[model samples]
Target: MKSKWPEKLRKGLHAPADALGNLFVESFHYLALFGIGAITAYAAVATFIEMLEKGGISVDDILLLFIYLELGAMVGIYFKTNHMPIRFLLYVAITALTRLLIGDVSHHKAPDVGLLYVCGGILLLAFAILVVRFASYRYPSTRVIDANGKDMDDGKV
Candidate 1:
């Protein structure tokens, strides 16, 4: 019969190795998120400086800034809750599309086509947001906030 000692020794070593792998993966995840948040913050500041150099800010510039704000807020929410909310993404898309429509309206060869396409996209996004809101309200998640405002699935509020 083959010796069982080697097999038992290998099994004993597996647990710590698996744990270390998990720790590395978790650490990398957080590091990537931090990098994304930092890049977004830097972009916002750079945009602000460019806007100031252009003499003054306009509505399109403000909307662009709002998109950047939404991006930062999305990253913050994900870090805080580990759950990304879809509404923030929708808000970002809507703001960006609006900014594009506003800034490029004068440049389009046929304004009607560009306006119709952008307006259609915005309408679709707004409809999707409404549907998501309705579903969330109708079929609420079991997760609830604790006193510290953290989500918990343990049926405690």
Candidate 2:
């Protein structure tokens, strides 16, 4: 013997509780994302002020700022779409390696094994970006929008 009600109506009995739980989880997620965005913005401003106090900005400083900006942008994008692009992460890695290489060559030391390693990392990340781009072009993802305007993947790729 089984319940006569359809699943939706049967589950509707606990829908209030389920909705409350979901609301709590969603609120917590929004709060965490806002906190991260706020902290990143504060850090970016602080870095700018520090650079001003130092009386000048260098290429490394600019690159660091770009990293911060990219991080903040990534957070915003994630908050909006709930999706993150892998290429953006690769871009961040490439920029960071470039900054590290520049800092090591001019500020810290002459060309060394560490510099070589950083250059190698940059090259690797660049290749990864190219591969990802090629894959996206060759094997495109088919997205269908649901009634709610959310992208539902057809999983064709």
Candidate 3:
């Protein structure tokens, strides 16, 4: 007796519409990336112009600009090389947190509360850095090579 499952599977696997759908999906990827890049470029330039018009840029403003620059750079690198350096995100987050803390301190009326928030933000940043370092040390992206040139995944030194 022939099985009904294999007959159905063979018919479904060779469907012509699936191939055409994949082509459209791939084309959309490039269009989306280009749109995102254009938006980011416009924002970065506009921000720089506004900062210049203000006569002087403050540390908080500089930090925010750096965050935007890093974001654009990260997107550029991702498209160029299909890999993202996680450390770049970490740096951006640190800078953003620093900017938030600074802005909070400058504008807030209560010194004690501002100081507490600043300290908390710093502590959180330090902890995140430590976790990233530990993870990298334990499971490095590059394989460890022996004298014989065989790559090893084992973390043992």
Best by lDDT: 1
lDDT of 3 by residue, 1-157 (tens): 8789988887788675677788788678768777877888888888889999998888987897898788888888878975776777878888987887778778766567667776787788778878988998997787679997776767554
Displacement of residue 5 (Cα, Å) in model 3 is 12
TM-score of every candidate relative to the true structure:
0.81, 0.80, 0.68
The TM-score of candidate 1 is: 0.81
lDDT of 2 by residue, 66-120 (tens): 9898889889899888878788899889999898888888887568788778888
lDDT of 1 by residue, 62-141 (tens): 99889889999999999999888999999899999998898887444557776889999999999999999999999987
> After best superposition, candidate 2 residue 119: deviation in angstroms?
0.7
In candidate 3, position 128 carries an lDDT of 82
Ranking by lDDT: 1, 2, 3
Predicted structure 3, TM vs. truth: 0.68
Q: Between the candidate structures 1 and 2, which one is better when assessed by lDDT?
A: 1
Clashing pairs for predicted structure model 3, backbone only: none
| N/CA/C clash count, model 2 | 0
Predicted candidate 3, C-alpha RMSD: 6.4
Model 3 backbone overlap count: 0
lDDT of 3 at 74: 82
